[model samples]
Each structure stands twice: as structure tokens, then as C-alpha cells.
Target: MSCSDPRGISLGPRQIADGVYWVGVNDCLKDLFESLWPIPDGVSYNAYAVVGSEGAAIIDGVDEHLTYEYVEKIREVVGDLGRVKYIVINHLEPDHHASTPRLLELAENAVVLVSTVGARILESLYRVPRERIVEVKDGERVSLGDKTLRFVYTPWLHWPETMMTYLEEGGVLFSCDAFGSYGALVRGIFDDEVDLDYYLEEAKRYFSNIVFKYSKNVLEAVDKIEKLGLEIRILAPSHGPVYRKRISEIISLYRDLSLPKPCARATVVYGSMYGRTEEVVQTIERVLERSGVSVDLVDAARTHPSYTLSLVAESAAVVFVFPTYDASVFPPVREVINYLHVKQAGRGRLAAVVNTFSWGPSAKEAVDALSRAGFQILEPVVSTKSLPSPEDRRKIEELAERLSSELRKFGSCA
Candidate 1:
């Protein structure tokens, strides 16, 4: 759906079983990409409605603007908005909790369910009443009629209070952001019904932008869930469309991302003051490409950090090219390097540093930062002043040779 559609409400009511439904609220926030840290294509806010014999329960709520539409859809399906007995806040993220206050007011007797950490965040952030909150521990189950809702605490899957809710009878897991992506599924909400390639790209972008930093915690949380041995018939995440089939594939994808899998490729990202460092990056790209190694040339000034992190996560090596200014690497390149270090993105990868300066120790300093970040240095760093002479080119060739050798070793392992 176009962004400007005033009635841009895309909702889904997929029946899980008798008297149960998976309600998907699509693209609840308008212009979600504009607000993302490094920007995204778009995103959806998925909320589920579970109908039972006694009453109904809404798993999560969309943003303020979409709450009324969400309430209306529930009323349409269940015949009454007042019958919603529980509002389970799987995550207190704004996209999921912004409309919660209004929903609680409408649901009257419906209790707001969340983890203790989630409750604290909601009270501090949204001023949600403490008495209305129902704190659930990990593996805690709450019965809503014939179906039981089980809460699994998954902290730092991007946020501390994040958790997943599973419908015991339905075998549907409402994963807040664990297997989520950007972009709403306009026509359908299941993986089998949509274009897998497009969704996978969005998923990668989402993980790269929002979840890559907390990858360690993600792995731990995934392991915890696996130990529970719940029969997962569908994977419903808050941001992206649901996975009604191939649930194992999505779980495997997340598991793989949590592990280290490096390719025999190098990404040379550089920021240049003038043409000097740019020349070096171009030379390195050509040198690597000629040796039958894949290379990605990213101008740090133009490429976003999210895409760069993705490439770093996939590559066997990363070459940082910088122009020295006042005994420091260029700001953009420096920022990227620092982020990579902080996120530990260069794990199990070879790295090399190159710098262009009039006369300074900036190249050595930049190389030191990469070394401290746990990158295995493949060669002595290359530095140039004014322009590279034949000797400088020869040094670059040697550095390229060292890098190629490292990649060859990595290839043999693969």
C-alpha cells in the first residue's frame, strides 16, 4: 500500500484453530523508515488476537494512530471490543506499546500482561499503572480459556524487556522481533504467500540495523527457547509478516546469524580527503579482484553503517583505507571502525589498514584500533604521503599478496 493512503489499514485474521485467530496489523507506523537509525525500507506492527471461551486476548497493540483500527478489527471478528480479557505486551517498544494506554482504557477489565522488566519500562516510559500490570516470569503460562499463553523472556534481542508469547493449544509463537524484518506484507502475512527473496533482504536489513549488535544475547535466548521443546506451528513476529510454513528455516537463519560464517571475500571501505586514499582503495580492489577473490569497494562517506556491518559479518577480511588528518583517520571511516570494534563484527576475519597523509602517525593509530578489535592483521599497514611512488605501489602489492594468502587459507578451510 502507498504511504499516503489515508485508510492504509492492512489487517489479517488467519485462523490457527477453533476460536483462535492471528491478527496482523500492517505498517502501523507511517514513514517508519524515516525514523530508523540508518534508515529502513518500511516496517509493520503485528498484533495478534486470541479468542477463547471466556474472553479474547490481544497479544500486542499498534501505534496510537492505528489503535482504533485495531480495536475495530477485533470487534468485527469477536463481536465485542470489551471482551478482550488480556493485553499481553510482549515488548514495550514504542511501536508495540504506544497504543497500549488507549487499549487498556477500552478493554476495562482486561489485565496488561508483561515481564517484570517490561512492566518497569512501561511504567517509566508510558506511565502505565502498576496495578494493571501482570508480571510473568520466563516459561510462565497464563490460561485465557481453552488456550494457554506462555511467556518466554528473551532479553537483549535488541531490548532488555523483549519477550515471546506462545499460544499453547495453537502452537503459534508470537516472537516480538526475533525473526522479524522491515516492510509490511501488503497482500498476505505468511512467508509462503510472499516473495521470499524480497522478504529475506528486508530481514537482513532489519537485523543489520536493529539486532546485529545484540547477536550474542540473541543466541542465548534462541537456545533457551529451543530447550523448551514447544511445538511451533507458526512464527509470528511483531515487525514483519508471519512464518506459517518452514518455521525451521527461519529458526536456522537466526541460529546461523548468531554463529560466525565468513566467506572468502574482502570488503575495502575507505574515506578519502582527496584522491590519494581513493587511489589506494581502487588499487586494492583491482589487486584482490584479479586474484579471483570477491571484493566490495565501499566509500565510507557514502555507504551507511548498517550495510557495512552486514558485509563485515559475511566477509573473510576487511580493508580499512583512511586519509590522515591531524594524526587521525578521517571521521567517517573512524566512526565505522569504532562501531565495528564495539559490535565485535570483525571476529574470525583478517584485516589490513591503509592510510594517506602528508606526514603523520595516523595510519599506525588506525591499524592499532583494528588490532585492538581482534582483527588478525594480514600484513604491515601501508601509508603514503602526497602521492604513491612506485615503491608505495610495490608495498600495496605486497599487502595485497598477504591478504590474498590469508583468503586462500580461509578458502582451504571452507
Candidate 2:
């Protein structure tokens, strides 16, 4: 179906079946990141409508800014606002729920369906009335005319109230943030319609940034989805693009990421005073490369904590190099290490600590911090005062050799 480009509304509709439409709302967030990308690519907040012979149900709504436009589009299809018999809130995050208040006002008689937890959050956060809320549990079915919306409660996929709604009749799953990505849906809204490389990368970034810490819960959610055994023709997410053709491919990607296997790579993160610690980091990188091990060198001072944490989480090993000042580690490196410790991201990963100091004690304090953080130290802490003498250089080389050897062993296990 073709839609005219309106002033404040950009809608693209794909007919999933006889009466179901996959609608695309363009670039919900203009400025996604204040400190990160900090640019506008236009994000897409997608919502689907299952229009049957008798009535209609809107799966999700776009942001608040696009609520009226979404309502108008629904009217165009369903003929009147009152025909929207149900509004299923698959997620309670602001981007998806920002339009809820306005939508509730318009669909006055329509039941707002959500998980019990989701309903609580809505009432607490938005003051939504209890009478209009319809609480659902896992495996509960709500019928809207000929289509049946099946609720699957998936807790901690990202939030406690997060859930997925499956249109059993249409063979489409409205999975709200489970396999979503950042950026805006530029051209097509499905994996098969656009470049898989770009979407997959953005999806990885989104998962890493938002869902990496909840890997255990993500795995459980995937398991729950697998048991449903529905013919999943489409995976409609709240952000970025949808999965129309390659639904299993995207599910497989999430499963792999949720696994406990470490990446066959190493990340060397360091904070340098002048260039001494940086030199050691570079030397370690070269040694690891020579041993046929992939390595990523990150200046802890420059890289964001989120990206660094993701790299550290994926890598088989992590190497920390820092310069000592007043018997303490560099503030930035310390913060990064502390975050890793709190997240327990490096529990089983191989780690090597290297330090440089001019006239004070070596980075023993930093080494202790790492050890306390549960890192399996692969070698003795390597330290140097002033420049590295021949003997000190030899020690550094030995440390590199040990790190590379440990990485090889880790890779073999994987």
C-alpha cells in the first residue's frame, strides 16, 4: 500500500498478510546520544496494526511526538479511532510508551494491554488509570476480532516489565527490544530489504550497549521463544529495522552473543603518563600479532567506558598498562577497571598488568586492584622506572610472551 508523505508523519506500510500491516515510523529520536554519536540519523519506532473483520489492535506506538500522526494513520486504515479495540504495550520504555497517554485518551474505550509489571510501571510513571489496563501473563491470549494476540512475559531481556506479543494468526512476533538496533530505518525496514552488514553491526552495538550485562536473562528469553514453535514469518522490533525473511538468523545471532564463550581476540587497554606506558602497550600488541592473535589497542583515556566494557566482555583476554602517580593508578584506567570489577566481566578472562613509574613505587596498587577484581593474572606484574633498561625490556618481552601463550590456550579451549 502507498502512503502520502505528510508534514509530521513518515509512514511506510507493508502488508504482512490479508489484514495485518507492518508500519514504519521514521527516526523517533533526533539526537540519540548526547556524548556519543551526537548526530541525527533519524531512528525508526515501529508499531504494527492487526486489522480483522470486526476490530483492530495496535501493537505499539511511536514516541510522544508522533502519537497524533500514528492515530491519524490508524484512522485511515480502521476508518475510526474507536475501532482500535486494544493497544498492546510490548515495552514500557519511553520511546515506545511516550505516546501511550495520548493514545489512551483517543482510544477511550480500548483496553490497554500489558504485563502485570508493565501495568504497574505505567500507573506509577504516567498515572494511567487502572480500569483501562488489562494485565496479562505468559501464554495468555487476547482476541481482537479474528487475530489473537498472545502475550509472552520475558523479564530482564532489558527491563523487568519487558514482554513480547505474538500475532498467532499472522505468524508475526512483536518482539520489542530483544533483537533491535540503533540508527534509523533509512530505506527498508526488514533485514532482507537492506544491507545485512550495516544492520548487524548496528544491532551488535545496540546489544552491547544496552543488553550485554543481561546476558543470562537474554538467554532465558530466547529459550522461552524457542518453545513457542510458531511459524515466525516476521520479527517486529521497536527500534531500527525488522526481521522479515531471516528471522532465525537474527535469533541465532542473539543466542551466540548470549553464550559464555569468549571472543578469540584480546584487547590491550592502557593509560600513559608521557609515552612510556603507550610504548609497552604497542610492544605487547606487536608480540600478540606475531603469535597470530588478534588484538585491539584502546587508550582508556580516549575510549568511552561503554565501548571499552563491550570489548573487554568479548575478548578472550585483557591487558592493562598504566603509569603510577602518587602511588595510585591513572584515574581513567582505574575507573574502567573498577567498572569491569563491578560488572564481573573479566572473571575467567586472562589478564596481564603492566605499569610505569618515574620515581615513586610501581603500579602495585593497580595490580592489587585488578587481582581484587577477580582477573586471573597470567603473569607477574611488569613495572619500570624511568625508561626500560635492557633487563627491564627483557621482562616486558617475557610478559608479552606469557600473555600470548595464555591467549593461545584460551583460544584452543574455545
Candidate 3:
């Protein structure tokens, strides 16, 4: 509830489990997360304080800017930083570990718990002394008297050192970015407490932008957890709201999003410098809509790549329409394409290209880019010299028919 406490004392160290307290911090000041994606609703750097009879453990840390508020949250829960015997670094990324140095300084006796790869990164990234770090292997268990923390290695879930920390007794999984989202927990911390619909969309956006590339790895990690049969009662991630009431919902969302299943929808991402490209894009959109296909038309000039990538990740097909600029692809369109490539969003997806130019149109570069990015390029790509003529309209119609036919092969829309 409202982590905007100037004094850092009003917001909760909410009890997620019997002893696991949500001590995360909300960042409203930062315009962008990782200096890339916009965070209009802000983002939370979720951390948890797992207290036991003998010792206490802090699972993950907030961003560096929120360190003061974060440490105060820990102090509120444990009274003394010395009580924190284990500082579990589920992920070493700055958003999750930037406050680590200050944390280590305050919790002088606490040993930083990390995976083997995390052990290497601890020194390299944070310069945490080897003596102060305890590298835990996969399936290794650490005890805090009544509570037991089990390490599950979920590599390439965006980072090599990424892992999940499970509190065995509490049945809580401290999944540091794996099941996390982008929205800030200003109202409440639990899924039951906030607007699930809004948060879920933000979660998908987060996954599409940050974790879509490692979708295969995501499924693998999910499989690993399923095989372990650890009854994950609560899912506490490094960002967004914690999941208790809707644990299965988030898991299912992640599974469905990460899995290579095709939805009966198509995303049309286009950038038009002039009216030429927009006119063609609108025609394609109208055709796709008329064919009983759900379509998302995104103007790359207006919409952010984060949103476009998410739509493409779920869609069965993507159509790129843009005007060639200076014998090259449109700058905005190219940026979105590069993102699609990096996020591996085009995998198992069908793509079509439409390029317009006054002099020299370049569709090959865009085709090659999409082809290498894993899209199966549809034939009869519509390229126009200036505007859509009668023949150009026919080609556009044919492209639409091909896309609609391909979409139907995936199954019914609903």
C-alpha cells in the first residue's frame, strides 16, 4: 500500500507468508526502466524479509535510488540489520541488486547467497568479497532454523545468474524477475488487492519486452518447478504485485506467453513518413478485420516497441508496412524490427512486408531482417512506387488472403 512514504515508515512490510514480509520499494521517479522501456505506472523492486526463529533472510534488493526506503523496510521487519544472516540475490541485475552494497554494509554478518554464476558476477558486478558470498548450487538448501530456503537454478530467464529462492516451510517462491511485472505496487501488494486485469497486461508487456527472447528457457524453468512438486503457495517476484490468490493465473499466463502457441490474431506494425505507407497499411488492416481475423494495428511512430513486441509475441502473424527512407528501412520501423529480433518475438510467426518509395524501395533488407529473426516471410510482398494503384491494391488483397489463410490454419479466433 502506497510505497511513496517520504519517511519510508507508512507503507507495509506486508506479511506474504507466516514470516516472509514484502519489503519491496516502489519507484515513481524513474521515467524509464533500465533506461529503455517507459514506466508510466512506475515499477516496484520487490524484496522480501523471511524471518525465522534463529535468523532472518532478505530475498533480493531494490534499485540504488530506493536503498534508503528499502533498508528502512528491513529495519522495520528485523529491528537490526545484523539479524539478516542471508541476503539472497535471486538475480544480480541492477534493478534487483543495486542496493546490495549498502545492504551488505548494514548487514555486516550476512552472507550473500547466490548461484555459481552469481558468485562470479557478485565480484565482477558488485565487487562483493568471495568470503562474504556463499555460492549455492541448484537444489541446495539453506536453513534459517524453522525456515528452509531452496535454490532453483533458472538460467537465461533474462540473465545467466537468475535463480528462484523458495521458502520451503512457507511455500513461497522468491522469483526475482521470472514471474515479475512492470507496475508499481502503490495500492496493494497482492494480486487479490489490486486490479488484476491491468497488472496482468503490464506483466505481459514486461515479459514480451524483457523475457520473450528466452521463452524456451522460461518453459524449461516452469518444467523444472513442476517436476520439483514444490507447492508454491505464494509467488513473490522482484517487481509488480505478489501472487497468492491468483498464483495459477500468473503461472498460466507465463506458460501460455512463453510457449510457442499461436493465437488467431495478427499484429500490423507500420511506420509511415508520408501518407503512402499508411494508406496501404489501413487497407491491409481492413482486409484482415473483414476476414474474421482479430488485428492489432500499431503505428510504430506512435506506439512504443514494448507494446508492439507484446502484440507480435501473441499473434499468429505480423505485417510490416513502411516507406523506405534513403534506400533503407524506416528508422522507427527498423527499431521495432531490431527489438523483435532481440526478443525473438518473430519465432514461429508469419510476417509480410509492404514497402513504398518515391525512387528506390528496399524490401530485401527488411525481408532479410525478419527472415533471420525467425519469421516465415509470406510471398507476394507488396511494394509500391508511390501510392497503391489498381495492381498494387490487387497485390495487397492477395497478401491479405495469404495472411487470412495462414491465420485460419492456426485455429478459430476464440
In terms of lDDT, which candidate is strongest?
3
Q: Write the per-residue lDDT of candidate 1 for residues 156-250, one digit (tens) a residue.
A: 88779889998998888999888887776665667876666677766776776677778888898888888898888888888776887778877
- TM-score, ranked from best to worst: 3, 1, 2
At residue 173, what lDDT does model 3 achieve?
Answer: 91
Enumerate residue pairs that collide in model 3.
Answer: 46-238
TM-score of each: 0.89, 0.87, 0.96
Q: What is the lDDT of residue 21 in candidate 2?
A: 75
User: Per-residue alpha-carbon lDDT of model 3 for 1-414, expressed as tens digits?
Assistant: 233534333356888889889998888899888898988878999999999988999999988999999999899999988999999999999998999989999999998999999888777778777689999999999989999999999998898989999999989998889888887776688898787788899999999889988988899999999999999999988889899999999999999988847756999989887687888888898888887889999999999888888888888889999899988999899988898888874475789999988888789999999998888999897788876689988998899988998897777656
The segments of candidate 1 whose C-alpha lies over 4 angstroms from its true place after superposition are 1-18, 28-34, 38-40, 325-327, 342-348, 359-361, 371-374, 412-414
Candidate 3 lands at a TM-score of 0.96
Note the Cα lDDT for every prediction shown.
0.77, 0.76, 0.87
Provide the lowest-lDDT 10-residue window in model 2: 1-10
Reference-based TM-score, model 1: 0.89
Is 1 or 3 the stronger prediction by TM-score?
A: 3
User: What lDDT tens digits, residue by residue, belong to model 2 across residues 348-378?
Assistant: 6678888888877556676677788777777
